[model samples]
Target: MKLQVVLVLCAAFALSLQAPSSQECWCELQSEEKAFPHAKLSMVERNVSDCNRNVTPKKTLELESLVLGLDRRIALLHRDISVLEKEDDGELYGVLSLYVVENEMVEIQQMMDKLNRTMKGDQHLTADVTQQLTELQAEMGEMETFDTMELVKGRLATQLLKKDLDNCRKSLNATVPPTQPPQGTCPHGQLVNVTGPQVFTGGEYPGSYLYGAWGRDPEPEPGKENWYWLVMMTVSNRYSNYVRLYSSLSALIVGKSVPGNIIIHSSNPTTNTIQGPNNVLYRGALYYNCYNQLDVCRFNLTTNTVSSFELPKGTRYNSKGNFCNLDECYPYTDLDLATDESGVWVTYTTNQDFGNLVLSKVEEGEPPRLGQTWHTAVYKQALTNTFMACGVLYGTRFVSKDVEEIFYALDTVTGKERFNVGIFMNKMAPNIQALNYSPVDRMLHAYSNSNMVSYKVWFE
Candidate 1:
């Protein structure tokens, strides 16, 4: 009898020794899988047998312990899942890491499903499982469109993050009370103050320019006002070999370059010109329309980050056709992206709209995005270029090269239009290809046939 009792006690001791430690049972992800393209199976610490924990009857110690284990395990599981969520540059098997997260999400979803089935009848267990299920469902939904890059991929990602945080907030609101405050908060947009028919007979800029000699002082934040950027290409026949930026129009004579190069992609940086008259400068980035105006690109001067967003569907890019007035079409000027007090704006006519100018807010983000859109009664084909200022959109027609600025303004605020603004270009080429107004110094910068001209505005 004594020997049998001793044998039974030893058996119980051995079983207790075989149980898993908390770290091992929590199924944390291994260090090796921390890199991109992590496999679904390798992410969790446990294998199939360990993951399929046996269930026990209600009111029993085993059942209570099982529920506690699941709760703790899920808490740890979230930490492992977050490793995949916080990065944008990670890829798996040449695919975005978002897919890897999706795969692992499915695995956890299955585990949650299994637990729900095992604890089906109990009210206490069901509530806990349902809450986790709600969270998992929300997270899974976010990953579905995780790679979508319309407008701005970063903005959409931010929205998803906001949604996730809101869901958590709702849960917290249900349990914990409120703590009051937290804050926070394009296109050839509009044209303004058209002055000038003055002529710079001297070599204002020395390039047989291929259509681009645009200039703007950096935006008027505390330190950036004194610096100006003027872009020009030396060769005009095909594309320029070099796209140069000078401190000012006169600064071009001295031949000084900006500190770092503005690397152009989507087209030949050295060869292809930025494709519109209405490129803009905001914050530290230069926003331009490219790919024949089918796309809008943002180049960050400070970070050197270049991101591009496609224009609306059925918009004419490539300037295969011209942006024409009733009399003639201007070559290579179909899409207009400009900046003003608001930020950035884009002007393009879509085939769906039957070539009517559709103006939209070009917002800044990972790639930039389209915001509120306003359609104009004016036919886009009738305008050569468009710009934005204050809360208005100003459009230009292709008058003769010798003519100064002839423009019309559309108040986006009131949905009103004013014709014959009578802005003129002086000391510049009669064939003005680009025009932008800077709110910073309140000057109009014009790019005409490879020449850079700056005019001070007397806004009436």
Candidate 2:
């Protein structure tokens, strides 16, 4: 019995000895187990220690970089905001400003990504790092709110600026110079300025001159007030069909006359002719259309050289399917040319049963090209019409058509017709042969067989 009890005691002692110390057993169990039961606690302890040892320095460096990046972004945002504030409504500045906010969002997301990667590496750091990340997310959300507010503010400000600009334009347009009586004392029988005959003189009419026409001078020369230059188209009236060019100061005609300077002459007589001289000054160059050959030419007064370009061969000049010809049977006459800050535009008529309006753009670059060609719907009611005018290009609401004897404020770019002034129909009796705009006076001048009249135009 004594031996058995001793044996049992010894066995108990041996079993106890075989077992590890508490800390040792804990470590051993961790090694033996498929998964450590105290894995989270172990990670927590190690992370705590590492945090104490390295987090301060690492966080300091990270914050420095983050702050630097944020400062740069903030500065950029401020600059963009300033720009947005100054631009008109619908200006791309606002969109560009929004890009700054987007960049910030991207940066924040990248920071979050980095934070997430850091958290993944250390399980114990997850909660604390997640909390910090959440705080950053909240800050980002606040930034988003700020961004949205700024965008709204910028949009509102831009709208207001545009409105102000428009109002100023209208006010300026509505302003007119005080009216004055007709110049020069009148004799009894006929109106003093009414009975002048068409005159032509020397070194003037080149033999090549075919069709010569002129527009009313809106703002006349200072001393020779009521004077405007006439744009003359002269083709080799005899043979070769080669065309030449001329212009005349309306007040200075001596005989059946023409102007000097071969502004544009045809090189390939078989293929081209100076079609129509719709004289226009654009970007410091004089541009006109050559009707017969479907070409446009630019004469640089400064350079004393002419550069020519052609339109798409298939462009519909007038609705009548009259592509390019000078004969009356063709149903269209290429008449008017105008330009704005953006580019040059030309207007021509189609000889179809119903008169059609054709508008085209001149392209840019080393050598210019013809761009989009568009045509207006048939104006069957306005038949026998021979004149049209583009008074303003941008921020303006007016175009002049002679048939209705009205000034229509139409969106020439978009072809949206606006208000029309119907007061001038009675004045249309004699027919307005030429229409022109004077930038100096901001007026539309109409030339009839007998007289030249001016109308004030307003724009916004």
**Candidate 1: tens digits of C-alpha lDDT, residues 259-366:** 524656434533223654456667777776653347777767667666788877787776643456555565656667676666677777778877777888876688
Against the correct fold, how does model 2 do in TM-score? 0.37
The lDDT per prediction is 0.58, 0.44
Global CA lDDT computed for model 2: 0.44
Q: Cα RMSD (Å) per model?
A: 30.4, 28.3
User: For candidate 2, what is the total of clashing residue pairs?
Assistant: 18
lDDT of 1 at 215: 51
Cα deviation in Å at residue 173, candidate 2? 30
Instruction: Report the Cα lDDT for residue 383, model 2.
Output: 27
When summed lDDT is taken over every stretch of 10 residues in candidate 2, the lowest stretch is 187-196
Q: Write the per-residue lDDT of candidate 2 for residues 44-137, one digit (tens) a residue.
A: 5565565466545445444444544444455555666677678786856678777776787687668666756655645555567667556655
Cα distance off (Å), candidate 2, residue 74: 73
